[model samples]
Target: MSSPVAMIPYTNMAPYRQLGAPRDCRFVPVVPRVSIGALLSGEVVAAAVPVGGLKALEGVVETVGRFGIAAEGECMSVLFFSCVPFEEMHFPRTIRVTGESASSVRLLYLLLGSIHGFNRLPHIAADGRVFDGELLIGDRALVKGQATAGEERHFITDLSQKWFDIHRLPFVFARWVVRKDAPGPIKSAISDWLDEFKAREASLVEQAVPEAARTLNLPPAAIRRYFQVIRRSLGERDVLGQQLFIRQFEERGRSLLFQPAP
Candidate 1:
């Protein structure tokens, strides 16, 4: 059998690898946490790794081209649903979080701390009944974002948009990455796909929407709006955002991996 690649099970991610990759590129649906394990264990050569967790994967894998999921202002997914008013939120209280993307959760914490002056940010587990807020990511986030009523909309915080509001830089959520020690064929295939994707991303993503909409059970227009906000290729500002996020993550003492104490 051919080598596999990890695919994060998110509707927003449909514009990436699903658009087109080599026939040898067998895709296996994996979540953010397990993706690294799959890549390192040789279960997969490449994965649509989370930018939030990028610091963790350093030296283990390298990002490919500018191919990634980024948002200039609003991601429309990766939302924080606060039980109380946005301004009234203070995190001595625990917030229920979906155990999905650590990256998104971290971004939430960063925003809560930096922008909101909330130093005591603690995202509790899903089972916790006593919580001040709920963090929803991926497709469910999109649904809640879409289905929200007038006043309810005031409470939902879009993490990517919040980042842009504070930093004025595009926020990248995930990117295609390959193991540094991956087989030549795997790396070469990803490189070739990146080359092909350079020009085709805009058009290909548009064309793929109907299918993605059907598969994801979201409206085609909603999908279009999402793609409108989502930038598949990272640019200078996007890189800046990544750097700032890493710096902040590390400074907050939430470094992804172990390091020597200085």
Candidate 2:
């Protein structure tokens, strides 16, 4: 029987997930956080876990390929929307995040606290109308970005763009990982399957555009442009960005992650 490999169902991951997997490994479509959980709990053999979520899974999973969801300056989906200026807003949403990704929420806290010197981070109520700021990722964020285009009421910030401005590296949101304890053959198969996935992505992405357009509820052109923004193959700079984000995750975000000022 083939091993199960997580396929994150996100617009940014349209290339990999839209295309069917190899015979040796089947694609299990799930969101990023769930993929991580499934991998750790032995539900799946491998997955593309978010970079921010990798801190706790240190030696449990092995990093597969350098390829993943990354971008140099702007990733259109992972956006932070604030009604007022960062300093003026009573508290831009931090803890409450789009369930699609927790790493995005963590990254927001890191940027806010580390660079902007914010101390107290507030948790947004589930399903509450966001008054301060809201962090949205994946397809929902892309939809929000499209809806707010040309509007100035919401202060929209691209997390990847912000990271690039601060660090000059491509922010790696997630990377491929496989079970370390899985038999050697399974590990090798996942790696080989990833390489094949990368090589075929360009054609697959084009094929996926129409489905993505309908699914994401965005114009085809917008979907096409977004694919250009999200780079699947990770380079050296992307690796550096992941390192910085993970390294600074705790050091700079200690205030928000650990104890919040009341």
Candidate 3:
């Protein structure tokens, strides 16, 4: 049988495999924003796609919300700026990014600009050369300070923390979405598999990274945090949180889903 495809950036997805899940479950790690566009366009099928993507594809009927990744107070992971003293930021400047991320980067901007009250700074995609501040999410954000005690300057704005502060609940980042046209058995199987996988994440993380020392890099640690944030952001089968998130989609005023699958 062909393996199921899991698209997300978090590295803590291994537990799903360990828990008698499909070995064929191929994980396609991607940034939240753009990936959702592609998924809604039918470029891809199932993914832990961003909330933005979920908004685009709403009413497709096959998709559903799940889980939350909570970061109470301040998440040490998912740092926003690459430099210091966030209150005093350079404005009207173009910041360079690696050109791989989409959602978190923009989401960071909204959180800082719209909510946190920072001046709008345009993001310029550059091949190389670090800017004064850069938003680093997933594994990189978790272990960013490891190299030589801060060679790179970063102001840690925990996205999840800010989200909870505003929403009074966990922020929903992504969801497990099945295609509307997908077979019923396939959807049911995936649903069952996800439930089992969710239960096993805690035990897996314990064995996977028993010591916090191993997490100072953007590898496994970031992956762990990604899972952590996602789990916390979702609550009560994500019914209430999803309704709130839907408004965010409306605010963007973009078509969340493609007419036909990409």
Candidate 4:
């Protein structure tokens, strides 16, 4: 029989690679967007899907494990860099966002529409050069953020921090999701993989730094700090945070985007 296939994001591969690939599964590296599509298409039995993309999966997929990417506060990689101060960014609702993770895109919308009180959905700029505000995620966000520090007009806003400031809960970025009707063998394999990952969590972080630095083209120290700010394990509070996010998104009439897994 062929090994079950799993799609994992390039940005989130550090820890998984550190622990070595699962013997019973084929691990494929893909971006968050591709991962979601692959899962929906049945090309992969499981994927690490961005939280924002969950709504799209609706009744099709369900979370397989408690592990995911999250942040307690100030996730360094999911950032907003703007020419104007965050409070002053009112007149033009449009902003340029990196065409990467869907979760980051949704998070940006949630913040702008709910917290910032924008009357209209923000316009997403296709060209990066035309916007005063830009949303960046994953490795690109980290790299661009470093470059923006020297620019006096650029102001950085950490989205996770913004969410925490208001809700006091961690923001979950991605989670392991699989087709709801997947066979028992595939589900068992994924559960075992998560168990192995939890067992070597510390080593995963230590080994991930150098690899992540290479993949992100940032210094190892910087990658280390980024990892420190991220929470790979989901706790009770993290679950609450995700529920709050979904409830808030629904409240804003954007609930049609995702369906919670049964």
Of the candidates shown, which would achieve the greatest TM-score relative to the real structure?
2
TM-score for all models, in order of appearance: 0.88, 0.89, 0.70, 0.88
Query: Residue 126 of model 2: what lDDT?
Result: 43
lDDT of 1 by residue, 24-101 (tens): 777788987678677677788888777766767778898888777788998888888876765555545567666778
20-52 per-residue lDDT for model 4 (tens digits): 555567777777877778888887778778887
On residues 119-206, what C-alpha lDDT tens digit does candidate 3 reach at each position? 3444443446445566666556556533423454545566767666777655555566767865666667667767666676687655
Looking at model 4, which ten-residue stretch has the lowest summed lDDT? 253-262
TM-score (C-alpha, index-matched) for candidate 3: 0.70
lDDT of 3 at 190: 66
Each candidate: RMSD: 4.3, 2.5, 6.2, 4.7
Residue range 1-262, candidate 2, lDDT tens digits: 8888888877777777665665577888888877777877888888888887787677889888786778899999999887765555334343345667858877777776655465545555445443467778888888988899679777888888888887888888888888899888888877887788788878888988998899877889999999988888888888888888888876666533523212
Give Cα distance to truth, residue 32, candidate 2, Å: 1.3
Maximum-lDDT candidate:
2
How does model 2 fare in lDDT? 0.77
Off by over 4 Å in 3: 1-3, 20-34, 41-44, 59-61, 68-75, 97-102, 115-119, 122-130, 146-154, 210-233, 236-249, 252-262
In terms of lDDT, the poorest run of 10 residues in model 2 is: 253-262
